[model samples]
Target chain A: MLDQAFETLKTYDWGTDRNLLNPIDEAIVASQADPAARRGLEGRLVAVLKTDVTRAAKDFVCRALMILGTADSVPALAALLAEPEQSHMARYALERITAPEAAQAMRDALPKLDGQMKIGVIGSLGARRDVASVPALAALLGDTDTAIARSAALALGAIGTPAAAKALMRTKPTSAEAASAVTDAALDCAEGLLAAGKSVEALAVYKRFAGEDQPKHVRLAATRGMLACAGK
Target chain B: MNPSTRKISRRRFLEGSAAGISAFSIVPRHVLGMGQTPPSEELGGALIGCGGQGPGTVGGMGSGIRMIAFCDVDRRRVENAAKRFGAKDVYTDFRKLLERPDIDVVAIATHPGWHPLTSIAAMEAGKDVLCEKPMSRFIAEGRAVVEAAKRYGRIFQIGTYGRFNASRDPKQILIHKIMASGLLKECQAVHIKRGGLKVAEWSGMVRYEVSDPGDREWDLYCGPAPLRPFHAHRFGGTHRGYWDYEGGGLADMAQHHFDPINWVYAKDATSPVQVEASAPPAHPEACGMWGWVELRYADGLTFVMDSDEWGDRYDRQTERDVRLEDLSPIDQQKIREMPDPEPLVGFAEAVKTRQQPGGHAEAAHRTATLMHLANIAIRTGRKITYDPKKEQILGDAEANRLVNQPMRAPWRVV
Candidate 1:
């Protein structure tokens, strides 16, 4: 019955025949409340993803995996993150996968992806707060692709470890895009540090932004951030 | 048409029952394995707005049912969405889309100005509505839509999910403490986090040319907004920049950031008694950046929109509101015993069960009120007084004009 239900996946569309997809939809909803069923769904989805199928069919399976996916499903989803057609849906699942391995997958795929796909992977790293990807992400700071470098700067801020903060601070932003992304991230890093109660570390990041030479908005943010840190 | 007084035919309730019969084809909830018996019927939804945040809002509701109809002024957008979402019915007018009796739910993700009017119309047509935020462009209009939803007994949700999608943010926890502890009588600037100011202003800053204004349905697109020649900037993403259609960023971000404050204060049934802003003078035709604004409830609780400048100390105020060291054991235990915020139940589930979604109409309206009031305060450059019960701007003639704006020919906010 479960196998039969998975077969309906091939014809699934966003706003399509509900009665046709009921059994499969039930399984997806049911899996959310039961751990065993979640793992079972994950296993079956991974298997289905591995099979040769229409890209749309695979996209359907990936959506289900967003709620039920485990580390076992990450590799299959990761492989699709660079394929232009499937990359968006793949990244959507991986971004919410809640597994470290999903973060690792994006990091591993970074070198091979380009344009939006590459930028999407870098962004997923930041969203996941993959601290371990900081060094690799830092390298993209100097990349000729301004969008890629900006994505890296923001990702490092999201990672928000002292090391990530240091990397962002060390880089001399070359373009307007890079500068904006770095400033946004710097504040985020300072915020992350302050939230963790490492006021000294937070202040260190804020100080770089507080100088008169800094842009007015960044300077204003840094000055306020410094007060927030000192108060703590 | 005075939208406030527009009557729903008794036939709609009859249609509601008729809709019930065909609605059972919904995805069976039994699959989720919760203890409750699963409904065999699925809810069918329709999209009334096909541009900007419309698609994403529909997408985020997750898949349980399908939206069979798609509507937009832009034919290209409507058709593209129809292909992408498997929508069978497409139209340029929402009234035409509402003719589908099979549509059990409607997602009105149109511009902010249209939220109240579209939602009221959908409810009158016996459809549950999930409207995008800034429930109305003005306070009085929002109140009318809320009344319409109540009168029609329709399930209505606003697009902002911040209040419902509660998480364990430290600031939220502290705010909850202040609420549960009843220490808010003297509270001022007692809540704060990234408000009103982005460190780096991010805008498209792209020059928008109409390309060929006559080629698009410009008149219909401007529905209820003042009659004006089409400018691409006045369309999609840049609509927030103009006061003719929306209240700018404050209105746009109101539900996202202010809903929790409303939830804590239970401010839905009422609104701020006073709204004051210290921003530079605002533009008559467009919106600009605002400085800090204070939304003061009748009870002395002030919701401060913090500025970027240093020494605002809004965070310090929140900290001072509840320090664990300062609290007695009994008080601390009271804080501890206060229940954690429940996770937001899904909207699809809410529709199946005939209950409210996390971002229900009342809360969304009250939160949206804050943004509208701020805009009024900034525009008038004075501390404006508001009477929540009257739903009117108090004693300020010019400000009151904005409280209930007159729509152009062939449209009314009633």
Candidate 2:
């Protein structure tokens, strides 16, 4: 019956029935307690993806993988990263998988991909908060693609480390768009620093934002951040 | 993205639903999704107050769950929020909002005083409630809300997540560390310090200048409260500084601070036995800032909130302190493993499963009552006794009057 549900994903029409989601959700919850069941479900999903599948079909498979995917599932998802249509869904799944191998898969895909696909991998790496990827992410800050640079900045911000903060500063762009993204990421990094109780470092980040050139909101936030720092 | 997706899921959900889900069967079939619909299954709802907390609160519920109707006394707020959230139906009257049969839930984002009217109405209409906290303006209204929730068997969640999750607020983190260290077990009373630089203000003055005061449907906004001309401060921002709409800063921020404290101490099932306050005489129409207040339980555990010192202190009545090493290993382990609470995430989970959210109605009511009673003591300038079993203020006429405050028209406490 569960396999039938998995099969439905392959054959189901796009707008036909939402009830198709029921069995999928049921399987996800059921897999949580049963290791054998989880293994079976992951295998079924990965196996289905191996077939010539529709984008929507792969999307369903990726959604399921997000719930129950493991190290074994990373390679199949990584293969989809170069396919623009599937890259988004693949990252959606890969980013959430707790397995460090998913992070490795994303990091490995970095040098081989470009455009949005490369950016997606950068994001997944950040989502994974793989500290080891900092240097690689740092290098992307110098990339000519402003969007790419922005994404890399945003990803490093998501990673939120003193090292990430320093990388952002070292590679701080003069372009307004890239600078804005970097500063946004810096604010996030500062927040993370505060959360982890690196107050001095956080205050320094806030001080950077307190610069006269920064926009009003960022400056106001930086001012508030300094007050918070002083209060602590 | 698909209409058939919604229809099929709704039908499937009904078909899969168990014949009955008793109140005692707290783990409803919906949660397991084994024979039920998934979180991805769309359940529509309405936003009752669109101006303040409504939009953000609804946003946190995710894009999948749609708000079909929007209600607010202010026409501008309604039109703006409806357009912003893509809500097709808009009404100034919340009762009209409740009349919609399609709304599976109603997010009551009005001021705390109006909470009772909207929440009870929604629950009675078979809609689950997501209410902003200070669950009720008064103790009586809170009791009514809890009763309505039980009678209607609807999931009622107060919007405060302090009881449900770890907070990012510095003050909350301070409280969290204290709880994690096993310092919550009380010998007797507590004394709070006035940590924040700015003291709470209870100014009811409509200081800000506004061009169009007539834009709001003033009577609808007032609801059961005393009707008056719409002022910027009266209905919208800083309304918590007023007595008619809310119970000042303590009441406004009460659940945020106390809900988690109530949970950590297992005090959700009951209320304080007595409350006393030290403050300047409260104005008849405006809530005033309070100085020091004490809440004493029947078990002789006491809590004193001091605006002077600004930090929590266990009253050195009996035990000086029990360090981490002094406590039993079980409690220590429990503290160490105390689970992080998810707020909106849990609400979505509960909606799918029909279980109680972490910050459910009963706990909210208890915490609100704890805060409200302090306000009651401060206002009346007397120590007030409460019978938690009877759910009433005992032997104090003014305090009782405050709890069972009169309503003007078109609404009555259930």
Candidate 3:
């Protein structure tokens, strides 16, 4: 039945009709059925996924790749994400995979992304919460994309590492939204660090934020973090 | 020629109906194919406001639309604005320029107070309008302009510019589909905390002139709005302090965020739901300079919007299983490994076939109205029943009166 659906979708000629996801949905399920067929299907999926036009195809491909969860799919996904032609859907699917191999691949790709895509990649890394990607994620605190830097801070919090907290403190947001995101991300990272028995590190971060000279609200949050650290 | 123009030129222009160049473009490819060779560089547009947001609109638009003319009530702003963009035409009065018929498009980037009047005037003069968002200063004015477009058959676009991938941005699409699908058990409560800029009269350096009593065009400036003292920054072009040109932040960001819940979940306009303002009007209160406003749709879905509030409680992961790191390289490579379709461009293509344009005007209107009423709720600090069908506020006579202000005569919108 899955094969039949895939055959139907592949033949449907989605040349102009982009709204319907039924065809791609079937393809993903079909691709997921067997590993032996995965390699061939992966190439086809990669083509549709890269065009940034095939929404359903991308969805199916992403889901199928996640099912495959092998080392082979990693490089292709990374390369597609790097290109302008990559669909947001494909990038989104890649972000969802949790295989350790997938994490390692992401860790390797961190140095190459600069400016927008770098921020995007960092954000994806943070969401995946791959602890191994911490050093690279930590380095992004000083990234030029304040949104990326802000996301990095939050990603660190979500990852819950002391290093993530330390890096979040160094980020400066240019806009109010960026500032708020950075502060919140830092606070979460700080709390995570404190929970991980890095009280001194958390305290320093809190002190910097809590200082009267710092951004008033960030400073206030830092003070609160310090008080929380003191067990008051 | 610019890319858009060039893109249009390549298409074949049949006699009546023309094929669109791309789903993303508003112009039909056939029309472009029939036209003479396009311009060499950026396609220029005119801006009427020449104020705070006016210049920014031109800047944000980038090469998409060039600034060819600058028109403002004040001579100084018109000159200054024109200079910034190297705009060749400067008009103290917008009427003269609007009559010229040379400008391709006109952006009505004026104060909320002047939006309805200026936009209607520009539209009547047969120009496509990229009017600023929220679409109207008063509720009735918005309705009037919507009618005007129908009568005139003009391509009027609102500037509510939000990044809505409602069909593909899984989180957004999922929520809309869920709400539309009725799968959420029940929408217990929706608390939307929006922290953004308050539309101050002259908060920025952009300035406007006081209405000269003798100037006939002063009547045009005051079109459809109740006559008030010549304050600099009342609605938008003011230089003094903030004034009630519109309903403050309530009219600004609150209108935006409030619309999502109301539009997503069908709600009634009529029937009063109690409303209470958190802070006193006209005074800077706490860190939350903006106040908390709550409106209960007739469907029992309570929409809460707080301006100057802190933090988003709704996690992206919670909504759609998408994490921040989900966008990473290795994992992302995993994505290229998968396949999905484009949403907006798809819809843009759909529009050519005479189908809906992503979210249609009705959808936009529903949301815009929701936002507008929330402003009324905040300003009056009284539970105001809204009648969506009649497009009027039911009880609270004062609030109802405030719903549509007295328009400046002769230059009326309708």
State each candidate's chain A TM-score. Answer: 0.89, 0.87, 0.70
User: RMSD in angstroms, candidate 1?
Assistant: 26.0
Residues B328-376 of candidate 1 have per-residue lDDT tens digits of 6776677777777565555676676655566767667778888888888
Q: Write the per-residue lDDT of candidate 2 for residues A83-174, one digit (tens) a residue.
A: 87778777766766767888888888999989867876776676456788999999999899887888788778867789998888777595
Better structure of 1 and 3 per lDDT: 1
Candidate 2, superposed: residue stretches over 4 Å from native: A1-232, B1-40, B166-199, B204-212, B309-345
- The CA lDDT of each predicted structure is 0.68, 0.68, 0.51
Task: Report the C-alpha lDDT of model 2 over B1-414, residue by residue, as the tens digit.
Answer: 121222232223222332133343446544655534456566887888887778877764534477788988888888899998776789988877776767887787887778888887787566878887778888767876764554334678888776555444444444444444544565343434233312255443423233346777776777656444456667675777766688877776667778877765456667898888777555545666567778887755566666553333324333222234434687656655655433333576666566667777777888888878888887767788987866667875335646655443224452
Cα lDDT tens digits for candidate 3, B79-175: 8888988777888777677776566567777767677666655655555566665566667667645533322223355555343433445555434
* lDDT of residue A214 for candidate 1: 70
CA lDDT of B60 in candidate 3?
A: 36
Which portions of model 1 show Cα errors greater than 4 Å?
Answer: A1-232, B1-40, B167-185, B193-211, B307-343
Best by TM-score: 1
What DockQ does each listed candidate score? 0.01, 0.01, 0.01
Rank list by TM-score? 1, 2, 3
Q: Which stretches of candidate 3 lie over 4 Å from their true place?
A: A1-232, B1-37, B40-44, B59-66, B165-168, B181-186, B197-223, B226-244, B256-276, B279-290, B308-365
Q: What is the TM-score of chain B in candidate 2?
A: 0.78
TM-scores of chain B, in order: 0.81, 0.78, 0.67
**Which structure is stronger by TM-score: 1 or 2?**
1
